[model samples]
Target chain A: MVEFGGWDMPVQYPAGILAEVKAVRKATGVFDVSHMGRLYLSGPKATDFLDWVLTGSASTLRVGRARYCMICNEKGGVIDDTIFYRLSEDRYLLIPNAGNRSAVVAWFQRWIDEKFSPGCTMEDVTVTTGLIAFQGPGTLETIDQVADTPLSGMRPFSWTESAIQGATVFVGRTGYTGEDGFELLVQGNDVVKVWTALTDSGSVPCGLGARDVLRLEAGLPLHGHEIDEKTTPIEAGLDRFVRFDKDYVGAAVLKDQQENGVQRRLVGFTLPGRSAPRAGYNLLHQGETIGAVTSGSYSPTLDTSIGMGYVLERYVESDTVLDLDLRGRIVQVNVTALPFYTRPRRT
Target chain B: MSPDDRRYTKEHEWVMIEDAAAKSAVAGITDFAQDQLGDIVFFELPKVGDSLTHLGKMGEVESVKAVSDLFSPIDGVVTEINEKLLDHPELVNQDPFGEGWLIKATMTDISQLDGLMSASDYDAFTAGPQ
Candidate 1:
């Protein structure tokens, strides 16, 4: 276990990260994500406050659906990437990174006090609740064996409440694993029960180590690595999450960046070997440094070294050959598309 | 249990004399080292003919979670690195005591092994008493 965001969390189980990652990819895996922030927002003007505070259009988000977006400062730098679920016409539940939980709350509260106070209310439900991710291809079948409500009809990015082990469970059909999965939230006391039921049904209990490797292989963005308070989402190739039609905290700058290309573009690369590139490794092209790796690791499933980093727009094309300075040894790298691995789709 | 046929170091490495006349010795990380590193992914081993100082930084042991320095328990000139680790570093985790041997080197001074701990001493040292 390691100290993460003031929480002592497991980096990996005794089965190890490689086994855990393979299990999540081929079968089913569960992650205890209770350290993430779970904030409940409500009131008549909650949507308005959220729309102004978020880059996505809250007005268009239908009830029971969740939207992945980033909370950015006025300068277009991302404060935190988050997923918010609209539970009702005027209520929403937002999940933020654990390390940035307090910052997100303070930022949202600042906006509420300035514009929508008395009309908007935010409640931190993180401590009182537990969140775990049930992910992979076999998740649906595995969950059906234990969960009372079938998630077959639940659309991707939608949420529904179900009963499991005589406890109220909030299930969201959204995950960061680049695979079909659900995020299970329950009362703090019932977390162990719900987790046990899932694991008892063949779900592998995973830890943060596997989670990082899985996300990197999927080409997903991570806070402080791909996106940060100083790096705008535009530079990170996250334009799709930004609704240009709506105005928000960083609307002008993000829109301006959309029309005019940003300075850097984040891309994925792969080397065919066990020798992995690590964060802070220099990206070299023609003997000149152009960018630096943000996160990198050996993909156990893909049998290759994978990494993500930002480079000049000129080198962002797919299949563009580049050199990755692997600890002073310059090695060739093929600029692959984001997500070095994609799960096989099943009907 | 760590094999008592070899000498153990405080850095969690084991050295076994292979040829006394040739001054050849084989070294690898201990079971404790591999366990602490979790899953082995890549090993940056020194090439043949490279000199390794006693308890000095030799290369690196990259695991699934983090990168840690690989320390040499014996001072010597590298004779060979386990070629298998170049392709399958997991061998370190699978058989840390046998096929996972990292380096084969000609020892600078055989007396260096005397100051090192034995298998039982290492077990007790790692057990606590830090």
Candidate 2:
């Protein structure tokens, strides 16, 4: 176990990281992601407030729907990546990384106070909620055994609130892995019950170890690993998630950046050998430094080395020949596109 | 759990010598090593027919948490590599001493075994090296 964002979480179980990763990729693995923060926003202006604050089109969110969004500073720099859910006309749920929970709450509080919404009120309910992700191909069957509602009817990026183990909980058809899965949000006090039930019932208990490889395999950007305050949406290749058509805190600058085009952009690549190129490894093109790697690992699924990095816009094209400074040696690399692993079953 | 039939090293590698035609020694990492590694992801193996020095760095093993250098516990030439590990590295975690055994080398010098700590000695050394 290691200390992550004030939580002591296991990096892996006795099954080892690779086994847990393969289990999730080929079958199913359960994760205790209760460390993630969950918040509730209530008021007549809840939907309007989120639409104004987030990058995605939250205005389109109907009750019982959720969408991914990024909260940005006025400079268009990401403050925290979050998921927004519209539970009702007067209520919404915002989930953010545990490390940035305080910052996100403060941002919402300040923004709402400054804008002065007559009905909008934000409450940080992170401590009251427990999050779990059961990911992989077999997750549906595992969840079906316990969930009162049929999980087969739920679509990707959608969710349903149902009763489980006599407790009201919300289940979302979303996961970090690029597989069929569900993320359950239950009350904190009910965490042990749900966890025990799932484990005793045969779902694999995975830890942070496989959680990372699964996300990396899916090409999903991690907050501290791939995205941070130093990186902008344009440079992270996350501009698609940013809505320029709508007015938000960072819209003006992002619009200018969009028109001018960012000088550097993120790209994914595969190492030529079994050796992995790690973060901070300088990316070189034609013997000149272009950028540095953000995250790198030996992809168990691809059976090759893969990584994500930022490179000069001109050098971000597919098939670009690049070299990574792996320790004192220069390792050859090929610029592949994001999502090194894409299973047909993911759809 | 250390098996009495197998010999152990302070570095957490185990070896079992058989008086076969070539006096071969089979080696694998201990459960303690796998426990510390958290999860085994990739294995970099030495090529077949490559000569290795006892206690020398032979290859590397990578896990989600960190990477570790695999050292040869006995000097000899690698007769076979666990090619199956190239695809399923988790076998090292599942059965570190059985099918997960990493390499089989012909013993060049039996004297090399003198330097390795016994199972009890290895356990003591691992508890906190003196």
Candidate 3:
């Protein structure tokens, strides 16, 4: 176990990270992600307030659906990458990274007080809720054994409120892993029952270690690693989430970046051999340091070392060769596409 | 289990004298070491015929979380390496004593083995201070 976001969480189970990762990629795995913050926002002006604050246009999001978005500071730097779920006409659920919960809550409260007064209210629901992700190709089959409604036909990013053994559960067809999966939001007290039911039905109990590997393989940027308080969404290659059609907190800066290209871009690269290029390693071109790695690991699926890092904008294209300084040894790496792994489509 | 015939290093490497007349020995990381490393993904081995000093850096072994330096327990010249680890690094995790053996070396001086701890002493060392 390790301390993550002030919570003692398992890094891996007895099966270990490698086995857990393979299980998720091939069959099914479950993750206890209750540490993520759950914030509830509701008011007469909820949609308008979300439009002003979030990068994605929440005004158009219908109930029972979720959209991946980011909250940026006035300078356009990302405060936190989040998911906004429209639970009701006036209420929305904002899930943020665990480490940024307090900060995100404070940021929302400040915005609510400053702009949308009288009607807006924000509540921190993290302590009362338990979040679990049932992921991989076999997720639907495993969840079907316990879910009251069959989840096989649920579209991605859609959610439904249902019951599990008399306890109310919010099930969403959303996941951080690249695999098809479902995320369950249940009352804190009912977490164990829900977890046991799925695990007994064939979902492998995984830990945060496999979660990191899976997300990395999927090319999903992590909070502190890919997007942070100092990085703008444009530089992070997340401009699509920044809806220019609507005005937002950092709309001007993002719009300017869109017009004039960003100086640095997040790019993916793969090593020629087994030597893993870890975070803080330097990316060099012609003996000059261009940028540094953000997240890297030995990919169990690819059977090679792969990583994502911010490099000079010119070096962000496919087939661009750069030297990764692992410790002191420089190894050649090829700049590849963002997602190193993609799940096979079920036709 | 740690073998009685092998001498152990505090760093978790084990050396067993293979030919006393030629001052030759075989070395590998212990089972405890592999267990601590979780999954072995890569091994960086020193080339054969390389000279190493007692307790000197030899190579490195990388797992999912970290890359740890392997150390030589005695002054020796490398005779052979476990080339199989180049392709199947998990051998260290699966069989640390047998197929996972890292290197074979001809020691410059056999007396350096006296500095290493016995298997029982190593067990106590790993168990932590009482």
By TM-score, the best candidate is: 1
lDDT of candidate 1 over B1-130, digit per residue (tens) = 8999999988999999999888899999999999888899988899999999988999999998888888999988999999999888889999999999999999998878999999999999899954
- Tens-digit lDDT string for candidate 2 (A104-183): 88999988887747779988777778998888887777778887777867888888887678877788888778888888
How do the candidates score on chain B by TM-score? 0.96, 0.91, 0.96
Query: Which candidate, 2 or 3, has the higher TM-score?
Result: 3
Which wins on TM-score, candidate 1 or candidate 2? Answer: 1
lDDT of 2 by residue, B25-99 (tens): 888899889878865777887988999887788888877677788998888999888888877777888888787
TM-scores, all models, native as reference: 0.97, 0.86, 0.96
Write out the backbone clash pairs for model 2: A17-B39
Each model's DockQ? 0.83, 0.41, 0.70
* Candidate 1 local lDDT, A223-253, one digit each (tens): 9899999999899988889989988899999
Sort the predicted structures by TM-score, highest score first.
1, 3, 2
Q: How much of the true contact map at the interface does candidate 3 reproduce, as a fraction?
A: 0.61
**Residue pairs in collision within model 1:** none
Output the number of the DockQ-best candidate: 1
In terms of docking quality, how is candidate 3 classified? Answer: medium
Better of 2 and 3 by lDDT: 3
| DockQ leaderboard ranking | 1, 3, 2
Q: Tell me which of candidates 2 and 3 scores higher on DockQ.
A: 3
